[model samples]
Target: MERELKLTVATERWNSAEEWKELKGYAKTFMLLMLLSMTFVILIGIGSYMRHEISAKQTTYGLATVDIKQSALQGMLAEELPYYASNQKLDTFSLSSLGLWLLEKVTNVSLLDPASLVASEMLYSSVEEQSTLIHGGEGSDPAIAPQDDKNMSLAPIDDEYLDELLAEVGNDNSSEPDEVPVAPEQEEEPAQPQGVESAAKPVAFIYHTHNRESWNSETSNDDAQSTKNNITLVGQRLAEELEKHGLGAMVSDTDYPTAVPDYEWEYSYKYSRKTVKEAIASNDELQYVFDLHRDSQARKYTTAEINGESYAQVYFIIGQRNPNWKENEAFALKIHEKLEEQYPGLSRGIWGKNANSGNAEYNQTLSSQSVLIEVGGIDNTLEESYRTAKALADVIAQIHQSEG
Candidate 1:
């Protein structure tokens, strides 16, 4: 019986070992399948992510290219488009065609108005008349005497009075007789009217601060030098124009002994004030003073072509910081009106009445006729600015002659 029990135990052990091996094989297959499934999902996710990234990059590039193209188109429109259109005596082929083209091209830019541009040009043509009416009544000087039409009369002198005068002249001539004394022919010299001297007030004085040390503070040394050269050339031109109109003008540099800031905003008021005070101390028959400066606007120079020559745009800046602001503004308005009359669109406009913010005095307190004129930006060449100055001087000369 013991032998039989041992055989049964051995058979049971062999069956148990076979069942364990089968379970191990099934577990291994399940794990292998799970690993393969996970690998497939990871590969799909990576592919989807790469595709999405590439699409996003392409969209950004496309938008950037569109922006660049639009910018180029706008630049071409501003710079090149206007030259192709005719300005004088606009017709269907010129005005209408150009207007339609511009309208179509700029339709997407809703801010621009075609009518406004045309209106501005028309209004600019009538600036002189508008300015005169705006300032006061009548277009001529009011100080002259009125014509006397109703006081015309004719009176005859007495013949007896003339004979008596002749008899007295004969007696006087006889009384002056000596031993063969011959009377010299008495010639009456013409009498000149009072207050009719040849000397007249100057039109304007060109003033500037040549601060070499502080030139590079905001603009470069080259810019400052260009400004100086332009001013000098303009001064010469102005002098010539004044001479042509029989007016005496002197262009002198304003020397400030103390070192100060180059920029108008950074300049010390006390220093400027002191310098101006000293300059006026030696004021030898100076009538008008012009402080010349350059504007800070764009990186590229701004230039205008007038009468086949290029010129820079000028801005008339009046300072309300002085006690004589009203008088200064009046003087500036006179010049402004005259400029618009002679040359259209030469002046930018009159600015600086509101002194509450960012108002620099610019030494206008020295005289009622003082004004600060900004010629052009740093990008403008010296020749362009000089041309503008010459044009300004001509306007001033015309005004001065009219005043005289």
Candidate 2:
């Protein structure tokens, strides 16, 4: 198709300069309002962030209380879920952390990482599973389930004995002078402090699931703890002494605080299991693994007078929850025999506990050399505990040397 046309025309008569000027002024005012709003929003964000940081200053149990939550161990490989780690800390100045923190403040719910949430659900689920096994499983005895809530008693509650201990150790501090019980040795000068050449291959690994378990010597408060001076330091001392004696050793002072129930201790072993596995995985030479703990008994039951020196009594507790408990029992028996030979009466007989009474297997099914060693009690002094550690180190050194 084809067409052609041409025309000339002037501007419209409705265009007024005064109207244009008014519209331009309105645009500027609008821009100013927008700028003020932005500034107010920024100030609010900063204030919220500052408030959050101030409130979250206090320390937390494993994995901070980020409302969103999820929180391991084993021998048949390992459990499906990992133990809840309470050591996670939030970055104070991180933008993402700030925004999330604000969200948590605004909303009642928490926001946790996917993995952590999953792990937490799994851990609680496993607890329920263990409870079921202890209760209604085939071959489960009614005697084991006498108390409904006793399914996972962290510490043994022997009513009669515990009452006796409580009565003896009242809340107040002892009035008697705190003295260091000395060793007036009547035997060969406590086997000349033995030393071993430094080796790259680590032979032993020591850790405390409940590192806050303090003693009277360290904190002047038996049960109360100043994390600085607790059984954790004892474990480090043991590691240092062992390393000197040629048993190249490592010690972990990871504190697994009670993030759940106020006094529950069952989660401790699972926490230590993760630490031990990581340690052993990195160093294939780690053979001897110990989950050191302080007993909760009275002073008389925990202190041992041997060779004129005070040594905290050591007890071997084996868990029956795992299928490979026989291996753990065998090692405990061997140690018990050796201890008898070296320091008779110093070793308490092997105590077998299950989930029904105490933490079962205690991560023992992970390896043959795994053992839970309770050194001393809440009333025992740190000095006595250290002495026991030395004696135990000597026994382990002897065993390691024999193998070498």
Candidate 3:
């Protein structure tokens, strides 16, 4: 039979084709898997790059110069950009900064920063803060002055008015849900007790230069200014919280505009300076002095969420005009670092300003331990601000304990 059989070359190869078919299938599968893997890696890279770009744009650091012409560049550089380089440095120039500058000019919407845009002339103004922000929450301009200065009235806050406000703060507002508002999805949790009680003389003094600064939520007004509800209430809350931490804190509720004769908003520092001097003179034991203020920015720039609770964000301002501002900055840095550890994003960051822009000294020359604190903004709620006050007291107590 073998001798009689005749097979063509094609038939002979077909008899052993199983092996070749299997190899071809394997090769195709391997190539497909390789392509899929490469595709996955490319997608991941694109996503990562996009995330990093957005973060870089929003980041306060880096070599980004501000767009300062009628925009809030000066305010932002003064408020957020601590590591910003000199304007003369060509190497540090940022195209992003330039783009932001151009965008701000063309749109007038403050695409770059959300600071005090409405009141550039005043540095920080009550009326300017009430204006609607470009993005509903972001504007970096320092603040714009009202068109008619003659018609502007000083916030009608006096010592008598402050006393009335203080009297109400002690009363338990049972109708209010809580001192700290929670996120909608979060359930109300019992607040942890703050600090050990102690009978100690006051070492900290909390005062407000812009005592009439009020929150939109508290005042229910556009101006966010009132003789009834003001930043002095927040200072009072801080003093109470500090007391709970076993740190004696004295609060000043002096309405500067009313306290000083022929009061001018520009002379607010001068008025507050007298207050600080008198307090220091009265008590040499005072080591820490905090000038509490409300920022002119919108809610988004001044709010933070910790766990399920909402809190007003804080910023520490150092006056470069003071020869010893570095020492004060160091002290502020300690508190800031502690906050970053315990509660992240609670502090926006430390900012420095000299005489060229705003209140250059901010009374930092009075004491190396002195620092200006801007809590919340015109749009924050009293509950949010109180939460921040408690948070600040918690950290300050820790520092005090550590130092002691």
Candidate 4:
């Protein structure tokens, strides 16, 4: 009986040991599954965070790229922005205004529509009129004779008229003595007077003359003087090139107010027109008038390069709001063509008549040959732009020669 009891206890102990082993194996399997689930959750969180970071970075990079590209393009083409921080005009006339206008007009995105913005501004400001004059005035022909013959016969003769007539006849006779009936003098036609080639009149420059003190005031004199010095240097170079090509050219400042920093955007048109009209009145020989200026985009200073040397790009701006826009565009095209030929890729491209919200007329209405040339942005050193100016003078000389 004792041996049987001992054997029974041993068998019970063996069964308990087998049950404990099975529980331990189940616990190990559960722990392994839990670790795998936690690892998967951790990996998912890390992946999601990386994806968000990448997306945010891409958005930031894209915006910066767009702004830089636009600015570089503007500099190359010579479009005007607002003046310095003191005189801000860009807010009133935004590029977005022009962009929205283009979005409304252009059906396809593929077309090169630089004037989309300008067209919108036109739609709002354009007015249709039957007369050519800006102000209403009676149109008449002074050259036409009156229908009444009686009125013509009733006119009285005056001593002043008779004296003028006799004087003119006497002068004519003296000048044509060889034609008188004295054997015709065998005058040899005076050798037909060899045709004389007149030297080309030098190209003239016009700038705002008023507010000279403000432009070169106590606070901003250095900045203003620097800009003027650069301009004078460029003018000198242009004059030299013109002389080299036998095109007589001169650069002078119009006695008008200099464009105030903040006033350039809104009041530029008025000031520009006043100056140009004055120029026309003073010198009818003024053929090409260039309003020189600098830009404000920061990136333009970095992107422009010429002959492996980084420099500021130049732009040609035109206004589509004026009646003389077609001629202005033609003049711009000529400048672009000439510049590109002389300095390949130096010019960005000719901007359309309407692009930005700033003044469209830009004093171009004063003359068909007038243009606004933006040398570089504020960030660019004055020296870099002067180099560009030298190249530009060469190009202008070539164009002048060709025209002659």
Sorted on TM-score, best first, the list reads 3, 2, 4, 1
Candidate 3 structure lDDT: 0.64
lDDT of 2 by residue, 1-404 (tens): 12222221112223456678889999999999999999999988986665554333211111223453221012111222223222333222334654665554443224664432343233123322222111121112222221211223335533343334234333423232111122345132322111121355777878777678776556665254656787887787787778768778777776667432454454455556556656655555668878888776667666667789988877777766554556677777777777778886677656655544545556665567788888877777878888888888888888878778
Best candidate (score: lDDT): 3
Runs with alpha carbons beyond 4 Å of true place in candidate 1: 1-203, 210-233, 254-265, 268-275, 299-302, 353-356
What's model 2's TM-score? 0.50
How far off is residue 57 in model 1, in Å? 42
* Model 2 residue 274 distance off true place after TM-score fit, in angstroms: 1.3
Task: Write one digit per residue (lDDT tens) for candidate 1, span 1-404.
Answer: 99999999988999999989999999899999999999999977975665454332121122112333443444445445565333333233434444445443332111344443433223122211001111211222212111101111112223343344234334332321111211233123322211112244544455454322112223465434433344444445556556666766555443343334453323333444444443343334556677666565442323455577666666677655444456777878888777667665566656543222223355665566777766655556666776777777777777766777
Of the two candidates 1 and 4, the one with more favorable lDDT, higher being better, is: 1
lDDT of 3 at 30: 100
Best by TM-score: 3
The local distance difference test score of model 1 is 0.48
Model 2, position 184, has a per-residue lDDT of 47
Report residue 392 deviation for candidate 2 (angstroms). 0.5
Error of 1 at 365 (Å): 2.1
Q: What is the TM-score of each candidate against the true structure?
A: 0.43, 0.50, 0.54, 0.45
lDDT of 2 at 278: 63
